[model samples]
Target chain A: MLTGHRTWIYNNQPVIISTGTVGGPFEANGNIPDAFDILHDDMWLKQSSFEKAQRTMMEEAAQIAIKNSLIQKEQVKFFISGDLINQITPSNFAAKTLDIPYFGLFSACATSMESLALSAFIINGDGADYILSGTASHNAATEKQFRYPTEYGGQKPPTAQWTVTGAGCALVAKNGEGPRVTSATIGKVVDMGITDAFNMGAAMAPAAVDTIETHLRERNVDPTYYDLIITGDLGHIGREVSMDLLQKKNIDIPEEMYRDCGLTIYREGQPVLSGASGTASSAVGTYGHFLKLIKEQQVNRILVVATGSLHSPLSVQQNDSIPCIAHAVSIESGSDNQ
Target chain B: MIFFWAFVVGGTICVIGQILFDVFKLNPGVTLTIFVIAGAILDGLGLYDPLIDFAGAGASVPITNFGNQLVHGAMQEAEQHGIIGVVTGIFEVTSAGISAAIIFGVIGAIIFKPKG
Candidate 1:
């Protein structure tokens, strides 16, 4: 709903652009550029070419995470990822080229955090030292799989997510100096199946922020305990409603202290009307922008919860609303060293 | 005979695009861009012109049809000029459409007291 806090994060980077909408407008635009890498789950691989899309999105996600992580090609040690597709093409491709001994896992949107949680566990369990986890989703791909085509021109309300057309990547290591995955309290899928896809973002946004609140409670940290925390791609309306709800729970979150991935994902007035959603919205912002902030000592502790709306065609046909789930992954940059 | 289906199908596609605008509340430009790109891809794969030839203006007036026009115009230019065909590109291929949008946008801006 607002664009004020972004300046503090990027020193006022000119990344997000807004389109002028008429009054009575309550939606955020989610458009990014062509050259800007997207988290599209399918990468527009067409109906029969889904496998290729999966590979492209996953590899694209991994390459991005690796680049932002600044880890050598072989230093990744392990790859973790997941998706809604058969055999997890995104995760497969994320692991294929780097040859870091891939470990694929899927809990949908929560996979971002799930991967982080597992990576932290491995670091804690004496498995691999450095782990990279990510997830990617495409509007075209997800629309084809879950809804209609870009050609369908179906009505989408503000509540629905704009299925982020990109991937999100994260790198977790056993540094122990930065805010570690201190502890995580995961939430179950609370989808009551409100199948209207347009409003799905609104539905999912609450679950995500709530999980964040819970994660903070479990860690025994206050809302301001960490400098900044970011939520996955909840569009304009969802972001506003989530903050309102958080404040109701007495979580004093300054607008600057928290950010939404969708709000930061695009350059507006292009094509994508929402900010950014898919796996990429958070992936790029977190790994690219979020990690950069963490390293700069701008903020020490951060909590991130990648959210997913677990709506299936089967559930929609049953007159159900799209169900949403959120997974929390707590991360902190340890003293800017590790 | 084929024109009948062209009129029905192409008109339906246009109506869908419009409804997407009116009911779905999507902007016309974005809707146009998506369909036009889709039309270009379909034409590159060789599956759109016959319908256009059939529907005539029905397929030609809307933004999706404009995209088809661009693709076909490009293909025609490509054959005649070989590699240099796309050099002129938007000006040669989509001059009228681009001019129309610019002209209309300016006119809309001028005619309506715009406020951001």
Candidate 2:
């Protein structure tokens, strides 16, 4: 039900039954590598092109989710997925391979939670029995489309973020044995007139803050309700910027309780300038990493606020400022019926 | 024979770039820039023409050819118009590609949604 201005309360409490995560060599070498279901030794997973490689990752993740759930592909009623590639071809092609009814999504990097929220909405409303939702990105493919090709040798500023190479998928059902989706806060597009593509963290942070604030107020709860509040790919600069903004808004989230997927995905010495940013940034972190923590009882209740910067090569060249968005989903450890 | 040589030479150049990127772990951007600069220098020294003759489209199809063209244009104009040509002649050859990039980029932005 629509709870407030931008929040929805999933009264039926759809459950995420299983998840599949695939990561590249970079993520394999980074933090939480064990969280991934399949870790590729190379970025190109036997695909001739990086874009195809991204599609392979997406397909693999969906397959893994289905397999882990002990369900046949035919059992899945719908597939909602997306990627950072032009026109979101990766997800569409993956859907062709999966052959399930598809919903191609494009919220840039925030696609993970966007798909998740929609899947929950459908299942909660009795529209489908089971839904597969996912998002993926390849570092080289994303860089080639949005900026220069990796072979271009163009120097990127320190503010630039490395697009992650991975995919995350989850199987959501009306009744299942896993983490429950309690609430979701949809974000509005907020452009602060920042035009520099290199500084996406700064470009996306305001939208994240706006969504978080709305989620808190609408739920009639404070930051303490969640054991951890995670934001999508805000990296270092955006993380700090959001924290300051939250404090100014009288939202007191402890540093220990607040984290960013972008900062957590990679190790310190990795060449990611600011931090990681891509569809996979939050996907693998939440689906593969944090969900395991919740299942293990390491984390109880968490809020994942996935952020995305909606800008393309065309938008950047057109001198249009970056417009960003964030989508928040509240996940609890136990089933709502419990 | 010409197509064979073009394929071989082009493949070899690509192999070198691949080695630089995969084995040496060099950034792709840096590797590409190095190839472009190396091509321009080879053309400036008058050593690239033989390779162009030997490989045909192989030598000209990649970014190295673009660099060679820039030097070639600048040198021809410099001989006739002196130092001013050094500044303006390179653009005479490369302007088509650059302007096309910009024009298409703007058109694409205006026509399509940014994030979809």
Candidate 3:
């Protein structure tokens, strides 16, 4: 590794939304809708079960990983997974058919990296053989839990991200010089009790900033040491608020060096009522794109920060405050693969 | 030169919209709102129909259409009800969005008996 760390190996694969559900229209590429509608239906059908929707994505992620790695299911050791569900049925379902030990986690959308972090730790600890850490989040499920159902069609603020309809899973290895999960900076839930539910991106921004700062501090690593710093889907508003707030703290990370997964993954205006944020937004993008970048050695030392807004609709409905959390995981790309 | 000027001016305006997106951190919907508000304000003073003539969907698709509908509704309601008439009231002078929300909200409460 360029930074004297265990290098992580990555194989980036593009996620074609062929076999998955799209909440709304996924404006194709930067400027084109798909040349033709490939969905079973001409229009996006809203599913009733969050688990059903989440599974559609998790399975897609697993299939992609299988194809990319060309590894069999039996080859994987422990499958560590989590999701924003009743008992994380999506991850459990993903694991049920797999040939591995499954450990499911729940920390809202932060579950992805929380799973990845622990996976890295276990791999480094040498207690586990080979593992796959994954998480799936559903847009409809998150909204029903945190805000309203799609049928509700409530007036959405521009800052809100439409929960992305996708899942992201990563295969972690203890051997064969794959991309190794380096240092994981765990984050505590930050509760500011900001009451404007419509502008949650702003509310969650402070927590993300705090976590990033804490992660760097705890690891005693500088921002310059990493080639790119990525954040989970915070959408347009959260991204702005996060960058402005971070710069004020004297963290001079430029806009280019940092990519907001929420903004990067979705079409600029595909009519995301809340904006772009669902478990799938980060999942597909990180698994599909960022992993590709890592494989290409486009950026070596990368810090992946996934943010979660831990507010359920019940809490909001009952006039309780929103608690947000962000987890940071460092994955160093292995030069040997390149 | 004149056609070139037209293309330059038209393209520059769209480019400015993109700049507002990239650098100024404006959401498409919010920026759309601003454009519509500006158009509506101008149209209120009888000045923007020509812009509509020049730029069809660009001017019409925004919130300016909302304003136009509200203005039309108010004028029609005002005319029909006369000075003594309170057609749909001032708050609901535009569309049934407010009226339906209040009336249907009460109906839903009665029917559903929602839990606290």
Q: What TM-score, computed on C-alpha atoms, does each candidate reach? A: 0.61, 0.78, 0.65
Global CA lDDT of candidate 3, please? Answer: 0.63
> On residues A1-338, what C-alpha lDDT tens digit does candidate 1 reach at each position?
11122101111111100000000011122332322333222234343344455556566556654564435657767877777555567567657666778878766666776676666666666576667777666555566566665544565543455555455555666542334455445766766444456565677877877687776665667878777778877777777878888888898888998887677655555344545566555655566566656666787777777777776656765667777777766556554423
**Model-by-model lDDT, in order?**
0.61, 0.90, 0.63
Which is better, 2 or 3, measured by TM-score? 2
- Give the distance in Å from residue B20's predicted Cα in candidate 3 to where it truly belongs: 29
Instruction: Give per-candidate clash totals.
Output: 44, 4, 17
lDDT of 1 at B81: 85
Error of 1 at A25 (Å): 26
In model 1, which regions exceed 4 Å deviation? A1-51, A60-77, A93-101, A152-155, A158-160, A175-181, A268-271, A336-338, B1-116
lDDT of 3 by residue, B4-101 (tens): 54455456556766676656656455666775566457766776566556665555544555565555455566777875334453334445655777
Better structure of 1 and 2 per lDDT: 2
Interface RMSD of candidate 2?
11.5
The order of the candidates by TM-score, greatest first, is 2, 3, 1
Error of 3 at B5 (Å): 46
DockQ of 2: 0.04
Instruction: Specify the poorest-scoring 10-residue window by lDDT in model 3 chain A.
Output: A13-22
Model 1, residue A33: C-alpha shift (Å): 8.4
User: Judged by DockQ cut-offs, is candidate 1 incorrect, acceptable, medium or high?
Assistant: incorrect
Best of the candidates, TM-score:
2
Ranking by lDDT: 2, 3, 1
Model 2, position B44, has a per-residue lDDT of 82
